[model samples]
Target chain A: MSRRTTLLTALGWLALAAALLGLAPALLSDFRLGLLAKYCCYAIAAVGIGLAWGRGGMLVLGQGLYFGLGGYAMAMHLKLTDAGPGQVPDFMVLYAGGEMPVWWEPFRSPVVTLLAILLLPVLVATVLGAAIFKRRVKGAYFAILSQALTAAFAILLIGQVKTTGGFNGLNNFQSFFGYSLYDPVNKRMLYFLAAGVLLASVALMAQLHRSRFGELLVATRDAEERVRFLGHDPANVKLVAYVLAAVLASVGGALFVPVVGIISPEDVGVGASIALVAGVALGGRASLFGPALGALLVGYAETSLSESFPGSWSYFQGGLFVVVVLLLPGGLAQALSALASVRHRVGGPPGGRRRRERPASDRTRPGPTTPQEVTA
Target chain B: MSVPGRDYLEVRGIRVEFDGFVAVDGVDLTLLQGQVHFLIGPNGAGKTTLVDALTGLVRATGLASYDNQNLLDRPSHAIVRLGIGRTFQTATVFEELTVLQNLDIAGGVHRRARSLLRRRRGVPERVHETLATIGLTEQADRPAGVLSHGQKQWLEIGMLLVQDARVMLLDEPVAGMSAEERRETGELLHRIGQERTIVVIEHDMDFVRDFADVVTVMSAGRVLAHGTVEEIRADPEVQRVYLGHTVEGVA
Candidate 1:
């Protein structure tokens, strides 16, 4: 990109972020602001999905596994805090016969909970990614493996009702770091916090998208054997992206608990995970803003649709996805490109010859969620 | 055949089996440094399979060593790290990347760091030099996928050159090219042969006659003849079973 284009893009992103960050507090009610905060957390995870699936082509279908890991860790810490000093969590006392599981003891410390939130998901993803990528597992097979992982994870959590709160999951937190949750002021603060984190995640990914390693990740996705022949391990390149995606999902999950005041198996199951990917696909997996904005829109639409139709909102969501897949294959990004081209036709000479002459073969392949070219 | 005191690539008793059939059976080969060796055979003659085994892309029991280090049983990527690079029978450049980016990535692989923040460009001097050698300097910014088939082949060769692999295993580098493209590729190989050992698997006998320093002809999973172009041509068994009318017309 030219220096002028790069500068314009940066400024555009900054202005957009500032507008988004200011809108909720200025216009929305406390409840609506909190709901937007929940969507922001989901958008954070969607950004990671864009990187891993859209750029790396890993199709991470089990991000819920990492999200749940971070959510549960944060919930455990909060539950312990609500129980007060040296007391077992109320749910544990009531459900686990008044004895806190020895495992939950360390989470009483904020430090350990935060560390586990950051490290546990990454650790799990690294071990899983290494084993899978090393064996050259990819495509739909990888998708199945990840979906199975999320299913099994949900089942395990459900079975541990006493410790995990089972089907009900964990909720009803009174405070976050001793700030009263009942205070509307503190509630809005959480929304800003989530917005700030989401913005930061976008910036981090933008940097990564420009880096050499980022380019290597895209190359590995397009041609694994050629990447191997180039003297760099494709598996390692993929593993790094997978681990980063897992970390992002984990961070999103951690933030989710305080903002939404709920962390349940339903929120981290196969359906939920697929919903996350659907948002990315709907938005344009290759575009930088597509995943996050798509996720927020999906969340908003789901809430609004469900309010109107109650039980049949899922059908509308499914129909929207189908429309995007069949007509706008590049998701909303393609629509944006089409609009820009139409504008150019109305105002300018027919653009560059290379852009005009790109073959249909190039268009047939799936575009990477990033700005890389379509593979042949 | 073993050549004493030579310490480059050595292969002995290499065998590749699939189910109950043998693809490459009990093949022994040796290579010296900086020699351009060509492996030629008819269709299904196990030439490509032997290259796969040599590069650790397939499982085989054999003493495959390069620079006294065992290349056998090692993964393909590890073999590349051991100063051995390869190109596929069909060109396998990352179609999404530009020509310069392709050569840059290949050249930068060795210098890559594990740090997330370490930003660097592709190896500039080497990539520019390789682009000139392959005559794709003008198309440096074009995506590899947009190039013609023959240019893609040259780009793959450029990739191997940029990687600086001591031993380059090019599989059918000129399989689908015009006569002029084939001649250009032959000249490119001849030039590259000055600094590296290249084991090319090709069916083009004319290209082999023009560029091969040593020729190994195989038929039905066995080495039928191994010698210079004239020596292999004179071997009756190779002529009768493998080359037949093909060599007479080409030579």
Candidate 2:
């Protein structure tokens, strides 16, 4: 990218960060702020999806597998910390009172819990993605496999009543890593944490988007056979994106536990996973900010629309998906770019800086990596 | 003819079967450097399947070795790393990427994963030279999908060139080219043919006769005749397989 474009992009991100991290606390209601924090967690995972599914062309239908891993890891530690030494968590005490399960013992250490949150999902995704990609199981077959695995994981969690709190999952944490959750200040800190993580993830994604690896990932998506003849292992390329997406989802899930104050099978099941993908498609999966913004839009819509109409939100979401896919295959981001270019043609000054080119998401040129590229 | 001790690709009894149908029966040929070797046969004579086996895109048995390394049974990607590349009958460049990106990716075989994540400093010297070689330097920034069909073919060939493929298997590269484009591609083959080995599967007899340094005729998955273009043109077996027709008549 030109130096000016790079500077403009960096400035755009800084302005967004100022709004999200510096100003949102003062602007939104506590309820809305908390909700935004939750949405930010989802955005983190969505950014990863953009890379893997959008750029790498791997339709990941079970990202909740990793999300659940991080959420449960955080929930376990919080629950254990809430219950003092040698004491069982309230849910376990109320249901199958005897001793803390052997597995729950490790989450007692904050370090261990954080480690588990980071490494466990990566471990699982590495194993699962390697197995799947190595076998060249892809497209709808891969999607079905991922979806089924998430379903089974949810079912397993529901069945483990004695250990995993069963269908109730894990909940009611009084503290988060020794910070009192009841305090408004700490809660706001948690929100800041989530927002900061989301922004950082976005910045990282922008770098990835313009990287040569990103170009290769798109190449692999378009022509896997041609990539092989180029002497590249397509599986490895895909695994990188898949595993990174898994890690991002895991981090999002970890933060989600504290922000939402709960972790359950319902939150990390096929429904949740597909909902995340829907948001990505709505925002433009191949775009750097599209996934994050799309996820936020979906989360916000679900909250507001579900409250107003109770049960109509699902139908509305379905309609939106169908319309966006059929009419705007590149999603809202592409439409935005299209609109900008049209405006430029009709009203822009002569010798305009912007070229009559396709959107950054579609082009592999050295343009701004952020969503601002639409305007740039 | 292959040099006695410097065979680039030596094949023996390479066969491919699907269920009970034999796609490619046991066949042997020696590909030598500095030559444009053409593989010509009737449809379903295993022209493509033979290339497929040699490139590890299909399951094949027997010895197909390059630089003493067996090409059979290795992964398709591993075969490419050993400096062998093949283009499909239809051009298969990454449509969404630019011409430069396509060649950059093809030439990036030697780059490690860590290095791939950084911004490309500039077009590598090799890619710049290849763009000029393929005459697509003007279209380097255009998305490959929007290129003309002939341009796409050149882009695919340019990709192999950037890949530094020592032995390239091209499947009907000029099948859909204009007369002028065909001539340019013929010159391209001869220009690069002096440094590498090339196996072109073509039905265009004029192209074959004009560019072939050697020709191997296949019939029913077997080598029916092997010699220079002139010798194969006069071979009686080739004549019979050509429906008792001449080379130009078959074309």
Q: Each candidate: what lDDT?
A: 0.84, 0.87
* Docking quality (DockQ) for each candidate: 0.51, 0.52
Give per-residue lDDT, candidate 1, residue B134: 94
How do the residues A212-329 of candidate 1 rate in per-residue lDDT, one tens digit apiece?
A: 7877888887888878888778899999899999999999999999999989999999988988888888888767778888889899999998888999877887888777766765
Error of 1 at A57 (Å): 1.0
Q: Which model scores highest in DockQ?
A: 2
**lDDT per residue, candidate 2, B18-80, as tens digits?**
998998889999888898999998888899999999998899998998877898979999999
Give fnat (model 1): 0.55
Provide the global lDDT of candidate 1 against the true structure: 0.84
lDDT of 2 at A192: 95
Runs in model 2 lying further than 4 Å from the true structure: A1-8, A348-376, B1-7, B244-251
Worst 10 residues of 2 chain A by lDDT: A367-376
A134 Cα displacement, candidate 1 (Å): 2.0
lDDT of 2 by residue, A1-376 (tens): 4478578668877986998887988899888999999999999999998888888888888999999999999998988888888777888877787666798999899999999988998899999999999999988788899999999999999999888988988988899878999888888999999999999999998888778888888778767877898998899999999999999999999999999998899999998998898899899988778899999999999999999999998798888877776676677877887787777767876665554443443454322234322111
